[model samples]
Target: MRIDAHHHVWQIARGDYGWRTPQLAPIYRDFGVEDLAPLLAAAGIGGTILVQAAPSEAETDFLLQVAAASETIRGVVGWTDFDAPDAAARIDELAEQPLLVGLRPMVQDLADDDWLLRPHLAAPLAAMARHGLVFDALVLPRHLPRLIRLCRRHPELAVVLDHCAKPPLKGGDLSSWRADIAELAQSPNVVCKISGLATEAAPGWTVADLRRAVDHVRDCYGAARLLWGSDWPVVNLAGDYALWFAAADALFADLADAERAAVFGGNAARVYLRRRGRGGSRR
Candidate 1:
């Protein structure tokens, strides 16, 4: 099963994602499994991991409920107040929902630079670590210092760095970002996602533009610690679904079919350890 390791589900009424501008109005529509089936089907993508986008635990519960009803959604990366006084109990409750696979802090908007290592966040992060939950580090270039500090402090928490640490491909300043990413990839507890480059590139970016960052991640993380994600609607900001996927497909098409499958889906299965009869991806 070709699994999309990252995607988001949200409702306008639930809580507004202030980032959703009128420019992103197309995605503002409701996108449930019903809307996703065709996209997944067309791409031969079998299952996906539904990640959290809202700021509330209520959104996590809602995603879990949706995953429960759909075979296409094989896993979920939900959000939680890791600093909450009842964090352990809350995680225990989330674990009961079977498909709940991980957690994300929406790290991009966190107010304080040191928030990741603050005393309040420790208990929640530790709780997730105890439960063997992978935490997706959603960060931008500015947050790398703190992110690195947190990973160094909690070597046990498995983290998948979203968007190759969100490089600025369009700006063409790859020096510092690549260095930081290489440093981060050295950690055995972390993995990198070769996804979301389209959104960060020049509006007309093609296969070659993606090659730089893709090559960086492929070189740094290797096949084993790398996963693939669509970052769908967000990718739409730069190009359509087929257009975005075609870039990676082009870059890896020269490799053997097995290697191609590893980037598309196999890496995610190995990282998340999905159940039997679910994945058809090659390692």
Candidate 2:
């Protein structure tokens, strides 16, 4: 089953998604599964993993409700205070819902400097593994060492590196980013999103420009360790789901259909261990 493992849902009227600013106003309006359903169908995508963008627990419950009703949204990556002493108990409560595949800590805006590896963060990290939820790291390349340490400490947690660690591709200094990614990929526990590179590259970026960033991740992590994300409303900052998926087609062209299948969908099934929509096949 082909799964777009990462995408977000939000309602502009809902006082959430503060990242939607005037700069992003063009597409910064309301976007929900209704808007994306036909697009996913057009792309031949079987389902998607609805990721949380709201910075609140209320939003997590709302997302869960949304997932329960949307057949195409097969999984969800919600948010939680991983450092909260009650986090494990909270996650246990959430675990009753099977579609809650993981949690994201908003690594892009954290203040811990080395937050991912702090000793104080250990209990929640351990809690994630104990509860069988993945940790989706929304980080920049500079956070690689912190992530490596944290992942080593909790090796059982399935940690996904979102946005190819969101490289500074447009600026073209990939040396440190490349090195860090290669190091992180060495850990079998880590998987990467082979999505959102167009936004990481300069706006108005050509197919070739976007391909460079995709190639770097593919080369470093290999297709088996990489997965796809539409990024939906977020990807709209550069392009829509259709445009981003088009870029992926051009970039993933070198691989055999089977290999591309892994990056496009197979790896997603393995990560969350979802039943592929195609004949109940298991990864």
Candidate 3:
């Protein structure tokens, strides 16, 4: 069962996506399941995890509603105010929805690099651990140390680092990002997603431009700890889904069949779906 573990669906008219400005004209409009289903079909993608684009709980509910209607969406990574005093209760409430598998705070957009290490987040994170909800760390390279500290504090929480911590692909420097990724990988509780890199690269990026970063992640996390994600409409900002998917395929082509299966789908099932089985026989 193949899963595109990270992607988003948003409606512009909803007025929740603060980041969706005119500058992002390529993907500034509404992107619903209707727009994505065909692409999934063409790629032979069996299932997907519909992730949060907006930080509003209303948007999370909207994503949950979409997941409920779309057979292709196997799980959802929703968002909420992690710093809210009632966050634990909120997470417990959201956990009632069986498809709600994870939560993500927009850490990358925050001004503070140590935001994840804030004391107030402990309770909410503990509640997430108790509810079996994964924490998708939407972070940048600079934020990785604090994330590592958070992982250490809550050893049981399942944390997946999104987008290889949004590495400096465009700037062409991996030294800091590489060291931080390696440090974070030391925590068995943390996993990394091989997604969103296409958008981080300069326009007209070749597969070679991405090879080193991909290889570095593979070395740090291994097949079992790494998962593949399309990042969908956001990926359209730098390259199309087909192009990114093909690039990922070529990059991991040297892996053994079982390792390939784990990176492509199995690890996502294990990490996000919390399922030991291979994700319901691929939709």
Give the top-scoring candidate (TM-score). Answer: 3
Residue 210's lDDT within candidate 1 is 83
Tens-place lDDT digits, model 3, residues 56-160: 999999999998888889999999898888999999898888888899999999988788878999999999999889999999888988998999999999999
Instruction: Report backbone clashes per prediction.
Output: 2, 0, 0
Cα lDDT of model 1 by residue, 133-230, tens digit? 77888898877777887888889888889988789888768888888888887788889887778888987988888888888888888877778888
The segments of candidate 1 whose C-alpha lies over 4 angstroms from its true place after superposition are: 274-283
TM-score for predicted model 2 compared with the true structure? 0.94
Model 3 reaches what TM-score against the true structure? 0.97
* Overall local distance difference test of candidate 2: 0.81
Winner on TM-score (1 vs 2): 2
Clashing pairs for model 3 are none
List model 2 lDDT by residue over 157-210, tens digit each: 889999888888787788888888888888889999876687888878888887
Q: In terms of TM-score, which candidate is stronger, 2 or 3? A: 3
Among all windows of 10 consecutive residues in model 2, the one with the lowest summed lDDT is: 274-283
